[model samples]
Target: MTERPNMETRTILRVIVCDNDIRKIVLPLKPQTVDSLLEQLEEKLGLQYKFTLQFEDPDFNNSLVNLTDIADLPDKPTLKIVSLVTTPTPSTADTEILSVASDDPCHSLRTAWPETFEIPNFPVDVEYRLRQGNLQYMRDQTYLQLSGELKHEILEKLSETIYSYKAYPNKEDFEAVAAALIKKHPCLTQPGSSKGWNGWYDSLRWKMGNYRSKLRRAGCLEVSINGGKRRGQQPQRNVKRPKRFEINFLPNFPDGEDEASMESKRKEMVEEMKKRRLNSALIAQNMNSTFALRRKELIEKEPAVKNTVERWPALFTNGQKSNVNARRTAVLHGLPLLLGEDPTDFYKTCFDCDSNEDMLDTAIGIMTVIPEDSPTVPYSLHLDATTTAIILEGTVVVDNLENVPQAMCLLFGLIYALNLEYPAALKSTFDFLQRVILSLGHKSLKPKIQSLKKSPNAVMFFHG
Candidate 1:
């Protein structure tokens, strides 16, 4: 029998998995388009009803990226497959340096903001002018009224920051913020109005809501999810969010992982935990590598906490508990000065004002918590300047943190690592830091950080 010459056009590839259990297929012809390739994959992978497709690219250090264009496929490329429904949404410090996205594409947007009206800090030049503006207002009764350009620039950064937390802002959410803004700066109050900030409050309330409405109408899913469903409506409660700052909360299975591959890693972790001479390194690696699968169990099955702990006991260990994703710390050291607005400096710059010496030295009663579970523990986040230790409800858990940034970073990390929610007061601050600066866990920033990615010089910062 003679083979047809047309058969030479065929292509072969191996689905990314362990070498021992690789799934390989030869295509009769190279798929001419991305959709065609996806169709072929869907038909061949027996149990996969729906899937996401990624391929190794030498262009991205052999890291996998979504297969957007079939022509982008390299000859005989390896493909990583995962169910589309299970793309896990969402870091570590120095032992693993997060590479910057310098090689990734960057784009710009017209404006952005933080979720709250408590602006972290204005641009350095803006701050200076604001100070000057305040001094002048002392003699005359005028708030630090900004020029049209200055206001837009300021609000642009604020919009990016706000979008990180939520696309919508209501009166209850931002009114107090306006009051506090004028209170602190004094220069920012409008003299004509009895309350002093009617105009600013209106700007926040209407502007943020309008932005989402416009985007939703324009079918901008980035602001409104999927740009489908009803636009600009409040979501029913119980939308699943990262319990903490979980980076790999709902992530795609790792580059070459599926049920079997991940299960094997899980077993290996269990076996390693059994060993008297535990391999901490190997256990950590496996723990991190299996995050997507762990989340899949938690998200889809909604398993009892006890059942999960028994199956993966090692995961409940203190070491593993503290080892949650450090994605928010991703390239944190590389974070730009951001128009002289250092994101890390929020705590120091936060209360450095006309307050008495005691207020500046120690910020008492800043945070409080009443757990849903019984035995309500006191919720207090107090900073003792002299000892430089953080006291949470009468006990000192963290000590000698030395400075505010280190303490703040550790506190933020602990919140995520422990799967704790942000204190209601500081929720916006946490979201901005998580979604904007450091750029850790969670899917769909909703940066695009206000961002270093969003613009040449704008980043959001908030302090509680």
Candidate 2:
């Protein structure tokens, strides 16, 4: 007779395939080799052809890195069933060579992120906790509440994986990792966010920062140059970090030049803008050449809006593209957050803007609800069914806009371009766009922004 498996560690897992087309019945679980698991799955799920069963590796921010090995097929791990016949992604190829470098994830000579990466297996204790979490999730629907230790393990692994790609991941990149984590394991979804992973997003962001700091201290060249002391002239301002979808967040000064030469080029471009009118292509060319220099002024100098405009007037004037000018706004305005109400509760009314005139009409009510008796900036949008224009300080700043949405977008850029204050009544809504979305303004979040980003029940405040 064959040797009996240990009864103490014995677990019976029943597989439930949600798709009816697959012709599934309950499948019995037997932990052994990868081949055994495949054999069991093929019969029960009625998979007719060759396929790969990829497990979700919690180590690499729940990325589908579990391609092969019995080591990858941990007990109760999350699974991804991919058909072998499908076209492969760049990250899915089974090359013996690693796409990302093993020794130095950062400081690579490559211009872009690696298409594929593989993380090391999780520690035994971390794997045990993950198995327990998956088991509990299977029993009921309770999401895993990660303790401090487990959380740190996931963060550290993810930070290394991200460094293999890019050292400075912007807001969208951070969201992508957090989203993938929850997508792979619904159990790991933090309770707070409607997105279910906003907390993870925040955690990963901080973890990347801390990880970079540690690397910098250990003489990692990629992160070492980014230290505050090494940054140029203005020392008291924010450290230069990636603001948007930047490929090189903090590139060195173009080989042959220094700060004074860049300053000369910037001046030449300012004069060139006047000669070529506001619509010159040279404006962009110069701007591109001086990107590193511009970052220093923006990050180190921390100039005021008017000061920024004085450096380049053409910059603000060139920002009125029709698509970029406007976006679809909500039927609901900022009244919900201003009144301390949960905005998601009004999703029905908020999204239905077909016949809604809330954006135009809401301004009149904003004055009444604000703590101060008087209105700020003479705020309102004028729409007589022909065209809409934003009225700021009793002056129609720009006219012939397509809709209120475009007007709002144009007005927002103007607020920065012209160095204007956000109207007091809608300050929270405006602040949400600046501090939360764009990552502008003070480093420490204000109360309203904190409420929007961190408060579990508080969805983002909007303006429409």
lDDT of 2 by residue, 111-148 (tens): 34422223334778877777788788889988887779
Over 1-464, each residue of candidate 1 has an lDDT whose tens digit, in order, gives 97654666888987742211247888787788878887887676543335667776667445445688888988888886644432221112211212112211111111222333456577888888977888888878665657887776666555555544344444554676677677777887776787887877888776676665665565442343323335675663333543332222333344456879989989888887787766554555566557657766776667798999866777676554322222222222124223223222122111222232322433221212122332211011122233234434334457655444465677776666767666453444555567665567774653423444454322422221
Q: How large an RMSD does model 1 have?
A: 19.5
Off by over 4 Å in 1: 1-118, 128-132, 144-148, 161-176, 192-194, 205-229, 232-276, 281-314, 320-464
Q: Against the true structure, candidate 1 has what lDDT?
A: 0.51
- Model 1's number of clashes is 28
Which residue runs of candidate 2 sit more than 4 Å off their true CA positions? 1-100, 106-121, 229-464
Show the lowest summed lDDT stretch of 10 residues, model 2.
88-97
